[model samples]
Target chain A: MHFEYQVDGGNFSNAGVASSQFKKILKQLNVDPGLIKRIVVALYEAEVNIVAHAYRGIIKIDVNIDKVRIALIDEGPGIPDISKAMEAGFSTASPKVREMGFGAGMGLQNIRNNVDQLDIESVVGKGTKVEFEVNLG
Target chain B: MLVSELKEKLNLKVFGGNSGLNREITGGYTSDLLSDVMGFADQGKLWITLQTHRNVMAIASLKDLSAILLVKGQQPDADMLELAEEEGIAVLGSDENSFEVSGKVFNSLMQKS
Candidate 1:
């Protein structure tokens, strides 16, 4: 099964909608509880990244028999240094975003920790694409 | 302990999500960072934080948390109360700081266990 959600940048109010919906779908499909928990964490972090940094973004989720793949593509000021952004304490979020208890620099690390595979591609001044897959087996 | 029991035992004020007062609490986590709680908090735990935004309710619901206890007499945003009511995740409040509230909750849960 496949599903997609649009994320509005700078909108903290709608940040977790995709993750919540995806979690319901996973529950309906009877995915293992442990796997669902990991996927939800990765998905929520990816969703928040777009809300915090991108101009706009799309989250595409594809679920197969053995694994689930999530792709987050955003139009924004792309990460200039992927390596630095992947570091646990690096972030570019504005003070307003930080005030909401977000933008603590743990978003990408959380995604990496929860997913089995992670791939990221970015073009400075244009956009970024992050894809991750979790083994459901 | 059930959420209602904790609220009664701790004298917490109910801000919203009264429907979830009966939800069982398995553990507790205290953090002000949204991503930290999102990454580390487990299901059925009660989250203790000072954050009072609508997104806190989102995280509580997405995490399947039993409840959210606001420390230091913090109150939820208006929209946060609305979402908590809709999602049925209890929004609780206390006059104590996170440290005191967490210690009390820990002791309570330990006693039950």
Candidate 2:
């Protein structure tokens, strides 16, 4: 099955809606409980990243019989340094965003820690594409 | 111990998730950082925080938390309560701050266990 969700930047209130919905779908599919938790955590962090930084983004999920693939593509000020961004304590979030207990620079790392494979690509001023996959078998 | 028993012992106020009063309580996690709680909190813990936004409920639900306990008399936003009610994870409160509530909850759980 395939699913796509749209995310609007700065929409804090609706940030986790997509992740929650996808979690329901995973439950219906009877995905292993532990695997479901990890996947949802990665999906939610990625989803919040789009809302926190990008102007907007699209999340595409391709669920196969044995694995799940996810990609989040967004339009915004692209990452100038992927390596630096992956650092656990590095973040460019404004004071306002930090007040909400996010933007601590742990997002990408969290996504990486929970997923089987993580790949991120970006341009200086255009946008970014994040992709990853997890095995279900 | 069940969430309802904790509420009674601690004198917590239940503002929503009335149906989850019987949910099991595995432990307690106190933090204001969403990512920290998401990363470290285990299933069925009661989250103690001052954040009153809807995202708190989102994290609590995603983590399979038993309940959210608002500290320092923090009142949850309307949208936060709405989601808590829908998710059926108890959203309780106390007038004490994080430090005090954490102590009381810790002591209570220790006595029971």
- Which candidate ranks first by DockQ, i.e. highest? 1
> B14-94 in candidate 2: lDDT tens per residue?
989888889999899999988888877889999999998899999999999999999999898999999988999889999
Each predicted complex: what DockQ?
Answer: 0.90, 0.78
Model 1 steric clash pairs: none
lDDT against the true structure, per candidate, is: 0.94, 0.92
Interface RMSD of each: 0.6, 0.8
> Model 1: per-residue lDDT, tens digit, B1-113?
99999999889999989999999999999999999999999999999999999999999988899999999999899999999999999999999999998999999999988
Candidate 1's error at A34, in angstroms? 0.7
Top model number, lDDT: 1
The residue pairs in collision within model 2 are: none
Q: Name the lDDT value of residue A46 in candidate 1.
A: 91
After TM-score superposition, what is the CA distance of residue B59 in candidate 1 from its true location, in Å?
1.0
